[model samples]
Target: MQETGVKLSREIVTALVEDATAAPSMHNAQPWKFLFRPSDSVFQVYADLDRAMPHADPTTRALHLGCAAALFNLRVAAAHAGWEPVTRLLPDPADPRLLAEVALAGATAPENDLAPLYPAIHRRHTSRQPFTDEEIPRAVKDALSGAALIEGARLVFPDAWHVQTVLDLVGDAEGRDATEPAAAEELRNWTRVGAGAADAARDGVPDYAFGPRGRHGSAPVRDFAGQQSVPGRGTAVFEGTPQLAVLGTPGDRPKDWLRAGQAMERVLLQATLDGLATSLTSQALERPELRWTVRDPQSAMGFAQMVLRLGYGPSGPGTPRRPVDEVLDIE
Candidate 1:
């Protein structure tokens, strides 16, 4: 694994790509492709436009977020595998879909700070189940915030009133989705229900990962089973006072979204390592007006990129991911 002259081994390259694909995406679309240039030990990330949800994510902000998350994972994986990843976001402005290019340089030391988060990479899941009402410790919260800062973003735990407001906005988005045929169609297109689809398909949110219907709670979890009724899906009461955190960046461009996405995965991995279950709700941020309102004027966080729900609950089952071979191209 020499950084200057030698190409990365096939096994190591495969492992890095596998860890990258494990990142969470909107509806588990896994809208990312990786190209490994063995000649220069460079790994490129590209967005798969075919998998983009045009109706729900018109500007492709969510797509960039997903790809950036994978980019963060690649960095972590490289560190854990004894390489220092030098990443360049949007390396080519002409190709908007080319999100990032990571050049792996062999590290003198095998262990790095990101090595500790390597284990949590596989452990982190989007838990939709209800979390207990217990509050997160201040120290743990601070650590999560630090993780976001390292990735060039801010993570803020809003006050109760702000949390309530964001929850209300989420509810409004959900209500709009119920009547918005385009939104419903977009969700259905990315969600897999039957056993065949859930087990066989490599991407999309499966029926099992949808969690139970929100019988009573204000957790702001997205209900993937919009109108279609599943046979065994039961209703459950979620946490009333969910510990919500907003991740934001100073700007609202493609580069900002990419940084926010990296910050997001860093925070999530850190939280997972700290024994907290987490889920995301970008519903409010999906709408233009609502996205603006989600930002706290009193805080330094400029534009809210994501709303995170954190608490004590099940870690969630693993969702399906595309195989490394399908997503990676080696030259």
Candidate 2:
């Protein structure tokens, strides 16, 4: 009598939420929450404004990016579990904080494309360490761009000129962070320095994952440590020409940001599957003035949401995530 192949259960919701939280965010803040209503088999992804970095994400753009990244992971996890997730962004106009609504309907045919990325969900982490100067194959780049395209966004690999522009803008952002007390304070508030704290931290980037201080090469990696010295942290030379991809959308709105975030995680998961080390930076995008110039002039991408560095190198250690219990509330 049963027509549906899969049914939503509390256990399944728990597992899916766990996989979703593994997505990368600004400072690993994990600015997301999930509320599962088993009665309707719907999962509500909400923006946890408490986790928002006020100074760094004044408009909450980066916060939206992080939440949508988790949303993408949730879709992959659901598809892998043989459930088709019907998702809507900004579903409720009255509630600005509710980022997405995912209704799970049993699937006669699950999303094959998304199910393949399930394994990469937890495997993909923001690698802050130095990447080698190996050129990524054209095929890999095309796949990544295609991934973004399907998510209603564009992933553009910048030309050499645009790459240098990004580096310069990144440097500018750093310089501002150094001089601006608010920016410096925001960075300090989110990063864990001590061994005990970093070890016990449920969220935020830990000192151990900060990678070596950039003595040279100046890869686009954000120096989480800043001026605060980690006792054992050492300096290393990063890749000279960091391969950068700009993930953007035609319009810069809440929905567009959500799409960009989903596209971003899709690209990252694919990159991880392809065995590429990855790290992303919102430093330049943090500052409104610098954010505009991040996009390539010739590219059709209207706005740059995130700058990603991809190459062959260490995949970096896994960062901590808040427990599912802490982030998810079952109804």
The per-model lDDT (C-alpha) reads 0.90, 0.90
Error of 1 at 120 (Å): 0.6
Candidate 2: 10-residue stretch with minimal lDDT: 1-10
Whole-model lDDT, model 2: 0.90
Q: Runs in model 2 with CA error above 4 Å?
A: 1-6, 108-111
lDDT of 1 at 327: 93
Angstrom error of the Cα, residue 213, model 2: value is: 0.7
Model 1, 1-331: lDDT tens digits are 2455536888989999999888999999999999988888999999999988877789999988999999999999988877778889999989988999998766725545787889999999999999999999999999999999999999999999999999999999888888999999999988889888888978889999999999998899998988887879999999888899999999999999999999999999999999999999999988997899998778998999999999999988899999899999998
TM-score of 2: 0.97
- Segments of candidate 1 deviating more than 4 angstroms: 1-3, 108-111
Model 1 — TM-score against the truth? 0.97
Question: Which pairs, if any, clash in model 1?
Answer: none
Give the alpha carbon lDDT tens digit for every residue of 9-59 in model 2: 777789999999999999999999999876677889999999888888999
